[model samples]
Target chain A: MVNHSKKSINQYAGYIYLLPGLAWIFFVFAIPIIQLIGMSIRQGPVGQEILGFDNFIFTFRDPLFIKAITNNIKLLVIVPILIILSLIFSTFLYERIKGWQIYQTIIFIPVILAVAAMGIVFSQILQLKGLLNETLRVLRLNFLIQDWLGNQGLALGSVVGVIVWKELGFGTILFLARLMSVDKELYEAARIDGASGFQLMIHITIPQLIHIIEFYAVLLIVTAFSFVFDYILILTNGGPNNQTIVGEFFVYKYGFIYNRFNIASSVAIVYLLVGIVLMILRYQIVKRIDS
Target chain B: MKKIALSRIMKQIIMITMVVIALVPIYYVFVTMFKSPDEYLFNKWGLPLELSLENFKRLMEGETIFRWLINSLIISGFSVLISILVASMMGFAIARFDFPGKSALFVAVTSLLVLSPAVLVIPLFKSMVKLGLINTYYSAIIIYTGIMLPISTYLLTNFFKSIHNDIIDAALIDGCSLFQIYYRIMIPLSMPAIVTAALTNWLYVWNEILIGLIFLQSDKMRTLMPGLSLFKGKYTTNIPLTMAGVAVAIIPTFVIYLMGQRYFVKGLTEGAVK
Candidate 1:
């Protein structure tokens, strides 16, 4: 009887421990999300009439929204590119290339940097008279030089280039970390069987690192969708006729820039659903990886 | 043997080219910050003929830069501290205790780990305004702590669970309370993971621009990244001066990251990769 009461007391103590964290989460996350839902169904930023689905309809019909979603999808191209580059670079490091340690350390410098600051740096470099153009001109490759961030046709592509440069470090390190853990015996066995480097990579390395690849790929996709705002805001400010506008930037524009809270919340609800789905996919993949 | 040597050299070349690409802009930022406007215009691609502190001097002459740095330190330091305290306690409970809704709470945290705060910014902003927290340090600190808590708890809980249950069980037999077991056994044992979580949160809170941009819009209240980003816009014509601001903004985080990179990488890849 004493033990039973003690068990209850411990259970209550567990609640006591969780109370502060849970309270903060409830107030900060849960309440705002609930309020987000309520605002999405209303009319204006401060409008009050129950106009169910209207804000969502307006958001869907907006051309800028269509452009933003299209740009986000276009940026999805970066995922496969990132995976490929990261795989190749990490494989080089995994093979212990000359100066691999130096390369690894320098490669990750961009990943640790503030994207906003890097965007400022890139803004200077990609300017028409900037270092990139200067170098191209000196190389007698002036044909390759264009107004990288100023031109509508090339702005999104330029943004993608910058994103790849900054984000590649992270993917390389992630893949390298996983590669470092693979069973060496598997590779030794493959080598004794006369498997060439390329063949071993295709057969052994790819299969061994598939789970990390999936984890990293899904993460890159999520990044492409929601994490491009800083790049947009800092690099182009969604300019060149809004060519570089993305989903998160779209939401930012409506909510903060235009004071269209209702519409922004509606778009956010869409993104929230998408984010939840991606989170579920990620969780399942993580579970599979663990098991 | 000749073919293998060729391929090896080719790999070195490829890697070297990528390294240059990765580093040139960072090199540019540091180099340009020391150049005068005329020198910047003339020598866009080389070291300054002479080291000049004029740009930095001009930047420091304004008090806003110092204010922004202090604000960043306060918000990031405070949020990471609160997040560690609250998250460690919650992780202790979830990892070490038998309780109702435990699985539910765990699931909620893991799920929210992937939920970007960008999606909820509008309503969060409104709520912050309602709480009279707009333009105050608390606005960003509270939200940053909230956003970081789930991941922090997730990391700490996993770390705490990996601690042998035998230790806690033995402590319980010795009549140590759960709180006692937590501090005496968990915190000290989980130092690496806690530092990893703390560094991760610090990096996130420090580099985060969107939350700070909206929540702490007042000039005196702005943090480093957002302040520099705004500074970039106003001084776009003054490249050297702007680069100086960028330098100031990125250097602190860069130094910290270099010092604590092990924790940073571990924190980043902990749950995801492992």
Candidate 2:
């Protein structure tokens, strides 16, 4: 009798244990999300009366919205290139290339620096008269220098460059982790068959990373859409002619800066939708490649 | 042997060049912080002529940096505590017991990981305003906890489930209470996972800016990154001073990374449960 009662009490205690986290999830995520949908459709201010899809209609109407979408699309192109680069780097590291631990530490350090903090430092370093240009002048390659963050033509590219620099090592580390676990005999057997390092990587290493690549692709695409906000906010503030505004930044500017909550909420929803679509599409492509 | 030696040299050279490229910005930032403004202007490339703390002193004399730092420390500590406490319990229940909403909750938590709160910034802001928590520490703390709980709970539940069920069964037969089983056996066994989860959460809370920028509107309550952003804006001309702030900002995380270097480099992927 005592033992059964004790077990029953503990089972009921599980609900009590769950209450705080459930309540938090409810208030912070679930409720605000529903409210977000409701607020996005309202014809007027947030919390105001009436409902329609006019806000979303106006969302599709804006040229900046298109620009934002293109800007985000521009970010996606960097993912595959950077991932490949990181993969190559990881291969070299895995081969036990000299002092690769140093390289790992050096490369991975930037990943910890918040985007805003790094943006401030890099803005100064890449300025027209900053370190890069000054070095270019010293080397008599001044023609290679251009206004990085200040030029409308170059602003988005500059932001993307900084992002790529920060993000590359993460993929390297991820690939390196998986590569470390591969049986050494596979590499040795390939070597005995006269396979070079590059061949071994292609036949042995890259195939092993398919799952991680899929996961990484989904992560990168999602981050590429939503995570560029702080970088844009700090480096260019979506300027050099507002040429770099992505969805998150657009949501910020319209909602908080301009007091257009209805519009911002709709943009938020659209960004959410586009992000999901991108993730799904990436997953499918990865899945096909994976099989 | 000679051919191998030559290849090794070439490899070292390539690796060294890449390391220099990677480390230069960090080295430059650290170097600039110690340089006087005059050194920054005149001999920007070389080592500082005089090691000076003038910029740091100037930075410290201003109260904003200290306020922001304290605010950050407080919020990070608060969120990590709440997250571990609530998250561990929930994770334990979901992992160990037969609950009514167990599968539903697991799916919900896992799906929540995909949605970074960056998507719903506007609605979240409105929600905070309605609660009149626009500028409170508790608001930011609770928000951080809520956002982080999914990752925390996911990590802990996985950790808990990985424990040998026979061990728990043995404990239960020996008359160990439900709570005692968690603290005595499971927690002690899973210290590594808890440390990993806690460290990752701490870093996330510390580095987070978007919500802090929105919710903590006042200077006194604002966290470090947003404060750091505003600090850069106001003192853009004072390059060394801003560099000092940047150096200070990166130090804690850098030190933590060093202390937990193995976990950071090797364990991050394991931590990426999804």
Among all candidates shown, the one with the greatest lDDT: 1
Model 1 spans with C-alpha error above 4 angstroms: A1-6, A44-50
Interface RMSD for every prediction, one decimal?
A: 2.2, 3.6
Q: Candidate 1 lDDT, tens digit per residue, A242-267?
A: 88888888888878888877767777
- Per TM-score, the best of the predicted structures is 1
> Residue B141 of model 2: what lDDT?
92
lDDT of 2 at A135: 86
State the DockQ, from 0 to 1, for candidate 1. 0.67
Quote the lDDT for B7 in model 2.
69
Give the alpha carbon lDDT tens digit for every residue of A148-227 in model 2: 99999988888878888888778888888888888999988998898876788789888887778777777787778867
Q: CAPRI band of model 1? A: medium
lDDT of each: 0.87, 0.81
What are the DockQ scores of the candidates, in order?
A: 0.67, 0.52
